[model samples]
Target: MIAEQPKTNTAASKAMAKPLKRGRACMTCRILKIKCDGVRPICGPCRKNPKEEECEFSDGPTRSRTKVLEETVSRLEARLQELEHPDETTPSVTLHDPYSPYHDSRQLSKHPSTLLMPDSRLFTPLSPFSPTSATSSLPSGRQWTSFGLEAKSDSVTSSGSSSSPHGHHASSPFLGEEEPSFGIIQNLVDNFLPHASEFGFFLNTNRFRHATLLPLPFGHHSRPSRSLLSAVYLWGAHLSQSELLLAQEHTLMIRALQHTATDIMGPHPDAVLHTLQAEVLLAYYLFQTGRFLEAKTHAATAVSLALAAGFHKIRTSNLHPQPMIGLSSETPISLHPPHDNIEEGERINGFWTVLMLHKYLTIALEPPTSVCGTLEAPGTQIDTPWPLDITNYSEGLLHPDVRGSNTIRNFLVNIPEQGYQGQSVLAMNAKAAILFHRSAQLSGQWTPNLQPREFQSFAAVFQSLNRLIETLRHSLTPLAQLDVKNPYTRTIVLTHALTDAATIKLHSIFSYSDSSSKQHCLTSARNMLAFAGFNIQDVGYLNPIIGTLWMTACHVFIDEISRLRSMHTAWPPNTEGSEDELMERLRSGMAVLNTLSDESSLGKYQLTKIQEAFSAI
Candidate 1:
């Protein structure tokens, strides 16, 4: 037996000496920097602490989730610092706590997490390419209760300078006694409130009215935030039909914006939602007043503030049954405010309004300078759900039984019954805008890149767009289509016109020699002209993009007509639209341009271009 044992198994020893290929560490161990025996659903550490369910493992040897989150936090901290101390050369560092004037960079370095709320985990960065997978990392646990930074006191004053510590300059225009009288405030609301929603302004009229009753602490006035109140009155003055109000609209707007600018200098502007609201209204005012750059800047700031407040993510009221290891067993924890339906509805509406504005801005800012864009443009990614109707949300309806989904992305991914619910006018317009954006992107790339992959991609997208158009068309009822008196009529007309514009752009990409593509382009151009032709006077005022759509259609029509004429077809061919019909369409498009030529310099420039093209044909 001893002689047989002496013969060692070298293969077994070698196998034992080899290192084990360990799986990626779970999220819990990665955060704690401890070794993890990787397991499914529950890792070794998470298994011991059942409440650590957020523990997840990567598929490969990639950076752990904790590291990614830490990096994101670091970036955000830098961004916040930059926003607070825009002029970094200034000696007085902006501290979060208004009570304490002393600056301490050491505090931020020692406890960086202090600036982050307990539920900071919810601020997970999402990739545009993998949006669905991005959501998996954002496991809900607790409601975000803290503002994550100290609140600036109203009474605090900065040292070494006459400027107030609340972050206002000594010479701030808001410090003046230029307050609007009660009559002026009432007049402004009367003029603005009725037409506000028509242009995608989502400020709650009831809330504004209530705010007007609250007296300011600093002055004997019946208004809470002077800046916000001024903005309301300013917009009212601009929209006022009264000659007196219109004469002072510019001065009022400048004064209102000056008051709002002071609020921006505060320690943490994003902490207060009302500040964001004021910024948005100001942005809209700037837009209507033809101040594009300033409006865009204000809108961008509002979007950043909204994102900081986590408004892009859908807020739900349901509680997580799995409590953390230390929380009380009897009492459940809530992450969001309970029974605040109005605030929730406002967030929903606000997010979508900004998203739509961003899309409009992008279309406007794109090349070809004559085209006018939407009033407000936010340079931020939008991942919010489609806003429900005001009635449904205001009535305390948490969720509704929709056909397919709630999010705009999901709606596009899987077309809902008849595009979307007919009642949701906002959703309809958003979908149409999405299609138009895709068309613009596709056209931009088509000419430069003639690669096989590009063609294949465009072909696939174009086909999908056609299906979406069909779905949109089916969603509209005969009654809705013809109801010219309804406010929603403008939305419907613009949506259809944009859809046809997108179609024309897509079809125009194909070779002009290709008979089928040329015919499709001609048909789409005709459809766009027809859609925009109805109530042309009203459409121009409803949206600024109508002129661009008309111009695009005219170009397509002219190109097709020129092609047909070159082929020696004297009579109007039955295969294509008649020459007389094409000519009529062209004339109708010109009429719209001529009508809007005096509205702005852009309008006049667009009309000139169209006439030149028409004369050449």
Candidate 2:
């Protein structure tokens, strides 16, 4: 056996037995002064006896821990400075202030007043149905004239001599501009009153009319403020087809802005209530005109004002502070309880109006930055009941006893409470708005890497919202059962549209991956189309936000069309009929958008986008 075995190479045996030197040591090995195999990510020594600390390597020379900490602190300090002094380091655009008298040619050039003066292209002369066409072609003799001024004078005169009893025409900047004649004011009132509620005007119409149309001393304390009147005139001019009224839109808008701002700061008896109404009207006007940022600003301002005025806690009982906190709650200095049930109703409606606008903008804008600062406040609580008809308030029908803490938060969590009227049309709209906002938040926060428990929580909330939406839709008055002549008919139809839109939004995130979600989106899209079909003639009068809902439905139809087209391509023409129905539904959606586009810039924008998407396919 010894003779058969080949002599081993002594050099190779020594080479194999010698340990190779590692180029670097992992942090763990280096800290322990142990030999390392230098494996990347996880070194062999660390892997063999793994601990909670992860293995890491430094290509350069190792630094002291204190030095590393110092560098990190310096970086954080620099970042904090950047954040604290952003205006100094970053160039920013200042929003145009309509209230400022310093607006000059240079200022106008820097920031054009798109909110008041729309794009000329959007109001082309060639388009017969263009929003500006009626105003643009006014007869030479017909003109909007200022109080105590000649029709030929375009400039606003600051004359102290005026017939108004309050001297409002002389002292108030709101009335300093051109004032419509009595006949023109009446005409505008006629034009705006029918659609007032549609735009969140909660004042009693007859009271508003009587107060505003009176000779001089607008006697009642509840009379509309100069600012509120100006806002009403602005909306009236905006909605009017009269050449004279339309010509005054810009002047009325300027006056409204100035008046509303002044009224908020002034000591008017009903400043809070009137200013809230003015702000809401201005916000809706801006939104319809496609000035979304301005709309959001005004809406947020309304919400702030509402909160400050305690509008959210209307009819709420002052609760005693819990003993655990060891502090007594201060008795809120309540404003004299609303003068009457009508006034109380206005407060309730006002809170919901602003809340709806806030929620809608939260979903519609979906700003990249956090909205916690603007859209909400700490301990922001709402206990206001749902709104009822102004007539209901007049008849002494008020919301029953409140049974819940946070009306909205409780609804979101599906917490059952007694005596809450959740079935009213206005209440349903508010609920839909909440669902719309929550759906956006949920879909935005979703990620594939979410933990199982986190995902379960998300899914639970999503399902709960879905159930709520379904419940809301089922609880609504059937379209067939609604009185066509009743003004509330439009509201019912719109609420139905809103619920379907909410469903689409909630399911949109899972549309591609989940079959059930895709079906839900399609069904909702179809339902919205049906709603529009029934209300085609009145589509122009629906809330401008409905344009956004139309666009939402259009998205679902577009996706389905694209999917069907792809299937047809992949399967050799057999899927041709599959997309026909979807294309028709898409066209119906576009038709409603087109009807709205005549007056609303938002609608025009949505129509343009849908057209582009369809063309791409």
Candidate 3:
């Protein structure tokens, strides 16, 4: 055979060399500098290197599902981090322990998997979002259900203004004081509850930024309370953004919340209630991160909190109709009309209304309205019309007293109707109007058209989001007298961040829709920063949002650096050559997305959705 074996066939020769074929390697393999069969973007070579001849596929038997999930989650987190916080100068910290003084008092806790008690306050100041009348007689309207479905419920009339349910803590601006402690739960009753320490956990900065952005007003209380030492430690560990990192951290959070909810947080009513809210918020962030099931779990927990607060056993404030999250029997929530200050009571009512609306949106089923053995039949069926309602939730911004809260109508009233800021609002409104009008024009249905008059009820919510944006814009320009870096609360700034992020998401629909009025949408988006106090054209994260949001996981990091810089008193860099920079950033982001527009990946799929969606425009 050695002397004269016929030459091997070309096919055999080719087959022998096939395993050595060179192709683009997996991102990991390329970076690791290992010999990759250059698998054609995830091929045999990529899966099992030729030299190693080792098939790494777990499909062969005995592979652990938990390990796969953990690895999958880790990869996602790393990618998200890479997309979000690219810079290292500033970072956000998560509050692992409520007592840790290292964090700001306003930001108390955010343990992703660990559930904490909701702000005890959401309970007592009972102000349900139901109509002021005992019965709403208006025609039933279309409303968006929590699951994003359209449904109608009977509208029940609300009764007269109910008195504050918490007579115990009445008349006090705030009770004497809360005891200070570290690494343990501080009980409000006669005893100290050390249980909170059981669920305490911290997240790195990259992980923290992946969570939801707090709107203004809420941000005042949220940001400071969250600045803890452990939080700082976690944040400082990683300055740059990494998608793989964010996904992994988020996985950590989900696991933590899941663990806390099942084992540590839910046995007690009060703890369960708070944990519900925390879980809900965390879930909301996960949804934003494209993690649906985890988001659903958190949302369900939040609803469960509402169910507990509305338990037939507890008394509720008539003014606040929604289920209270963490009201405790030991310390009843303080809900009372101040003899000298009706305004404060109203403010509390406003807060309750917001909470209730949140509840209504998060969980489809509304809790039965029962307060203090006062067995009133739970409010009307959702489909019933309640036009005679005393308060229009959608119009939350219009109230004159919103001076205390950042409701919608309050902010829009002062827009110099014809000026640039006003112009932005007008354009936004016009675009919105066009959206509804066009929907009506095409399908001959008014309102969101997704539902008849029901979505109209959401007009208020839309208005509120718009107001949120306006307040954020105004907040951007600190009084020339106040320190720009350390303006008090910066409630406006935070609100702007949250609302801006939200609007970007909301309008992403338009990016894909062919619009006779895209200029309006794009312009309004640009003006978002102006409303908050920046040219927007110059801001790094906010600037690129115009086009990057739909493509390249860019949505995650857009405002991270600016937020960190602002939170820490560091000056955020000014964008040089504003227009040029914006255009360039847009180009890079758009190019990545366009490349993906033809390719396949989670990030690419999302952008393609935007592109295809806008084709109608």
Candidate 4:
């Protein structure tokens, strides 16, 4: 033993004697001027001395101080330059494929031209004093363009006419208090009508087109109200690819808002009905542009108008006539009968559309309070039949034999009703909307420590809603069976996507504790992604509400990724591939959202939120 000890390992002793170097010192150790072994949670010296102050490592600067100073100086220079040469500082707009794989996610997230940019100038409302007030100061011969819209230097007058400074008649008029020129109006109509249904346009398209496109001398009853017409024009400008029309967007918006206010207050044959339509459109427009509070206010107004107009109690031979409740005794009801089946069908569709919008707003905005307490409540009961397509109304294919009261409630409770079965796309969407709202509300009400009775009640409703969602999903027209060329194909695809989204929402609350629930959510999320893929190719514009659905699905993937990462310090070779697959799916979802962001401010907001969430992991 003595002989062995004589041969000491000098290298090992030397290595042990040298102290390990640390990146930074803890605050307490630095203050105490003691040798500190840097460690997370608690350092070695602090651990040895039980009474020592808690160890806290300062979060030092992420970038070098010199680098930060340089960035600050550069930003100041840019600001000074912009102020000195404001006219020359106008940013150039560029167009690119949002879904292209070559584009860097981090770069896109920080792009100055993105809708999420912090510059107030990007979203400034054009002053109502002049149609071109916002664009008037642009340098001559320099044009501002976006979204495939070419720019022009045509000057617009405050009056209802438009002309270039060179005295040339402009192609489009500056929309003012007066009605727009026939060609301008027609162009707006063409841009809006094709995608009308994508929003909540429940009126008959043929009737709307006839009323709007026809010149004056048509009967007042046959023509659209100023409110409705203005709203349509607003949407047209909002959706147009023409820079001329796009320039008038704010003008149209202001005109629409003013007309809607005036028409709702004035006494006209179609005041209540047309204003109702306008309010819905305005609400949707406001929502797409990130005016959530205004959107919610307009939505509530639409609901009130629908109720006042007696749209909730549309009369038919088979349905019992019910007096509207929740109205003050002084409130007057519209007792006049609809002129024809088309008018009557509009009322029916109108109610469903109002209900769907209300529910969607509730889900998307998650307002602190709802207009009507719940879909199943007595005051909110829907007696109107499920909506039939405009074509069905024209063909006299109405569901005259179907009864109405508690229509939505019966469906929710799993009670079979003749009218609720084998429904059309519009009807199915209405049904899905109810289920979607119910599931979201129920999930919010969930608690781990529910009393026995409460638990039982909650379980029963959950099971019923789950079964109904599955049934509705199966009843949907399959994507493969749809005619791709038909415009209605988009509607069908939307319904399917909505159903799948509902399933994920329904199971989301239980996903953490129940494996089956987790799998169900995962399956639904994957299906929604597939639908998104189809939508990207076939559908030109998506309703902004779909952004909520996409966000919900993204949450499912995010939760899954977090769970797998927590399971092991390093992923097993076998499971690593699956984790990468989930990440890919998440990226695909984000790409779809990015594409939507190009057209919608809400989509941009959602995409930014999801990017932040993914980056946190």
Candidate 5:
């Protein structure tokens, strides 16, 4: 019937009906060019990779491995081109510390300090901010050595086979009989370098790197200071927060302080910059670890040392001089044009750092009853210029092109026409702290029996601070393109919080009712709390000043919430929505404080205060 049913065609039909098998490998395996057993939630290969959270999958048409490789190669070539032909004006690599509050997205970076030792899988031969000879001012255009390597011993044994041409013993008195091998010292120094900026110890990154790599001759007076090195280890240990490291922190800190105290009281204290740097580091460590009194005392000591070392004065000479004294203090003796820039930059930064810490301690500590009040030496002035970025000064750019290059007092006396230099985050944060201090002082001067003259003076100071705050806020890089993970974001958040805190402190005493000032205070407090909530974890307990900001915001929120409940308790139900919203915001603030309470006692204390205050209602 019909010619054998057209030969059945069963085989052809079966071939046409068969479907193509989908890929069995997990997405991570596909991307990494490795075998994977397809699994849900997490694949076998991804489980092996520590960054399992980064593994992703899709059930769609995927590009071939060859194509992916080609695209990657293309990107590499383009990046190489850019690096090779970098513009002179634009920095080849904008060096940034991941943990520092000055993180900028535009800049490339190295592995920022973390609580854990750096992951070997993530290690690279050069830092993310690796400089090219043509693009950078580095003397030799050397690539940054990877810092994640384990601290290896380079000590020679009786066999004498351990001798390497590159290895040299940079022994310190603190090391005693067991001199730290080159690798050990390097590891410790690397640990501390990233954190220095965060603590207001502005070191010249390039110079520091160069010096660390190139050993100083034996018996050289300018050998890296043992005190500074010990302090670095202490900070690094504290920051790492490992149980072993935590145990070592006390020993390291005590040793660091011991060495520093000896240096300060020793014959050549004023001639050594490390003494100032070490004292500041000790102060930062103390402050970070909840020793407010000790921090204030050490900071005061550093400030006094800085003044004696001539850090507060800018060194200018008719003829540019050479810095023959290697790694010397920035004194009149070492005042030279070319080599002075880096040292001078450190000086300015160090001075401001001390001042900033002093302000923070002044605010955080209880006055009159506490020893903090005794720490402040009357009439101490910031004569140092606002510091330029270390990179700029490192390249011998003595004066930044920006207009606002004056002493702190002069700049504050007349808020520079240039709203903010924006050239250095260190400078900007310091400025914010200075305004905060002034605002606190103005707030403190208020008394019921104040004379008219005092009232006018305080009012003027308040107005000036307010104006400066507005200008400074305007000048900050817009947050539209901010990376939430960036440290700069924290800096911006802290700046806004401090400015708002100042405003609240200024107006709250004079106007406690539902006036514009009270409303402004409430709004600022809400903003600060919102910011704290968003970035609570990233803002960590390492920063004592951040805790102060959190405490102030919590106090304001609790007070406002209490006021709202009291006011609404007597009023009709019509305003319930507004009160509910206020309650919601207060709840958010309390939640943040609770989250942070685990990190620091200040957080716990503030959280308890808020809870008690709320319970009273």
Candidate 6:
């Protein structure tokens, strides 16, 4: 009577010990077996708690589901055939090999003969002093080549390429691209697109940028040469990491193929080896997700390959910020040396393409701000440069001379010294990568006396990214918004333009670090939202991009709000605490954006997207 006995359930206990059925799905989706819907992490069920770790799914029904569905569909078709034609029938399709892109028409991505040369073209310096496109003789636009493309034909007839359309960057980046077929470029992009939605979105976002998975510019069928060349071709597009990763990945493979092709055929040695650096980044990302061994493998591979091929010279700020070396980085890298010193790095142009690569490697292996200060100041005779932001390039970053900060405003100037226009742009991209990732590390600093080193680098990177945008914009023919006439809608081209615009909206980054202090940064953010809000009143589809900016802006705004709250909490006796007004000022200023009457369709779309994203934030 005092206690009742509970019944034991052996059935459930036994089930716990039994192996759960493994599922079929893509490597990424299968890893998180929860319910792939074929897309995995991005799929509906998996997305419920993006912050939570997704379940590994490769083992059970998930793995075989695609085949099962295909089989069922085939049987239904056969039954229908029996009811109609009766005699004719075929079994369901079967995957041939164990690779992602099965049955893709283009197979030989890289051959020893064609890709022999290390990636010398990827990080050479570009001309840095060119005037902005708004003021230049030309109208700058997107260039896939800078994205690192290497198509079979330097001159594919526009008519021949009509099967796939492409958008021309506003700038005439190519030597003689009068008017490439828009359809062909679209086809190329569509076919070479790499699927990398795993990391967060947007390569340039103020969030954890290092975690972002960059998109490829091509569809699945494209070969390596196409991707390498497309890097430059896509250069003017201003794509984010996800937007550019595929092309970048393709570049590595293509360079590899080119080198391999050379060994088999002869030694063209295409001289493109920066792909090793790209792999290191991907490995770092994987490492972040808890794949340490894989990361080590890639880092080691990149280091060895880089050294073996003399590709170590390709080091730039973004791809491998710190190669694990310290101040005396001159030690020869025999095999993809992980920590080459920056001091030993060679310099070129107003830019430091290969030089920055050393920094990139160092950063990846080590932590931030510990580069032994490899970044060099210009010679005494050379004047110092000013700081810059995305939309206001000429205003802050450069001296009237523009050489002090090593900001390469134009692509041509660095060509002779670096030997590859493509390599230099990538180096710049690497620097931007560092700055972008480091910026987010800035937790809200309330009374900021001296800005944190991370913030300083962020500001510095923003300046560089702005300079790049200015250079690309200046190359366009007449400064028109991108107008790609392709079926895939050629999102990369539009996204590239949008990414740049997004960068411009990030004026919020410099808030706490400035001389005016956190107060000034808060004021600046509130002011930006007001106009940015109006920009949305102009469009809808653009709402997605706007959302990215809005969320980032909110992070800063919210930080300031919290700062005010802290001030109220810690106000000294003489220090008056009528902080409600400060709060009202910011909240009310933020309100102005929503009230903007002239919001464009793109603006509204971006705003809405951002709002949904922050539904949690």
Clashes of each: 2, 0, 91, 0, 0, 190
Best by lDDT: 4
Q: Please, what is the whole-model Cα lDDT of each candidate in the order they appear? A: 0.57, 0.68, 0.31, 0.70, 0.57, 0.33
Per-residue error (Å), model 2, residue 493: 1.5
Prediction RMSDs, each to the true structure: 22.2, 21.8, 25.9, 22.3, 25.8, 23.5
Write candidate 4's Cα lDDT for 1-617 as tens digits: 45554766999768646775554556667778887766766778888886645566655445534447778999878877777787888634334774342233234334546535342222211212333334532111224332111112243433323222121332222232234446666778999888898788989898889777664411134467777887998899788886666765765676678778766544456777788999999999988888888898999889887776667766533454543323335665354567888988888888888888888888898832332344346665567777888678877777556656666666776676673333877888888877778778788788789999999999998898899999998888777677666778767766776787788878888887898999999888888887633455566665678888888888889988888788754555435236777788788899888887778778888999998988887
Off by over 4 Å in 5: 1-191, 209-223, 265-271, 315-340, 368-381, 395-397, 400-406, 415-423, 485-487, 532-542, 568-579, 594-596, 600-617
| Candidate 4 minimal-lDDT segment of 10 residues | 119-128
Model 6 poorest 10 in a row by lDDT: 195-204
Tell me the TM-score of model 2: 0.69
lDDT of 4 at 101: 26
Candidate 2, residues 379-444, lDDT tens digits: the string is 766666667667777876564454335777678777765543666677777777777666666677
List candidate 4 stretches off by more than 4 Å: 1-176, 217-221, 316-335, 367-376, 399-401, 419-422, 532-535, 569-577
Question: Model 1 segments beyond 4 Å from truth?
Answer: 1-175, 209-227, 264-272, 281-290, 316-339, 368-383, 400-406, 415-423, 478-482, 514-524, 529-540, 561-569, 572-579, 597-602, 612-617
For candidate 1, the 10 contiguous residues with the lowest summed lDDT are 138-147
TM accuracy, model 5: 0.62
Per residue, candidate 5 scores C-alpha lDDT tens digits across 1-617 of 55554565899668545642346555557767776655656767687766726445555367645557779999777667666777634444555565332232112223344324443223211122221122322111222221221211344333222122144332232322112345544565666665456665667765755654455432223444556655776666656644544444444555576677765433332335777778877776676555667787888887666665555554422222243332325533343242466676776677667677777777777542232322234644334456666776756555454332345656567645344343466666777777767667767767778799987877788788778766766665554445666655656666676777777766766555547777767777776776634555654333557667766766665666677667764543335336566677778778877775665445666678778877877
Error of 1 at 451 (Å): 3.1
449-558 per-residue lDDT for model 6 (tens digits):
65687668655655655554445434422213423332112222222333333343344445445534444345434443544233423332221223333444454545
Q: What TM-score does prediction 6 earn? A: 0.29
Error of 2 at 158 (Å): 16
lDDT of 3 at 13: 71
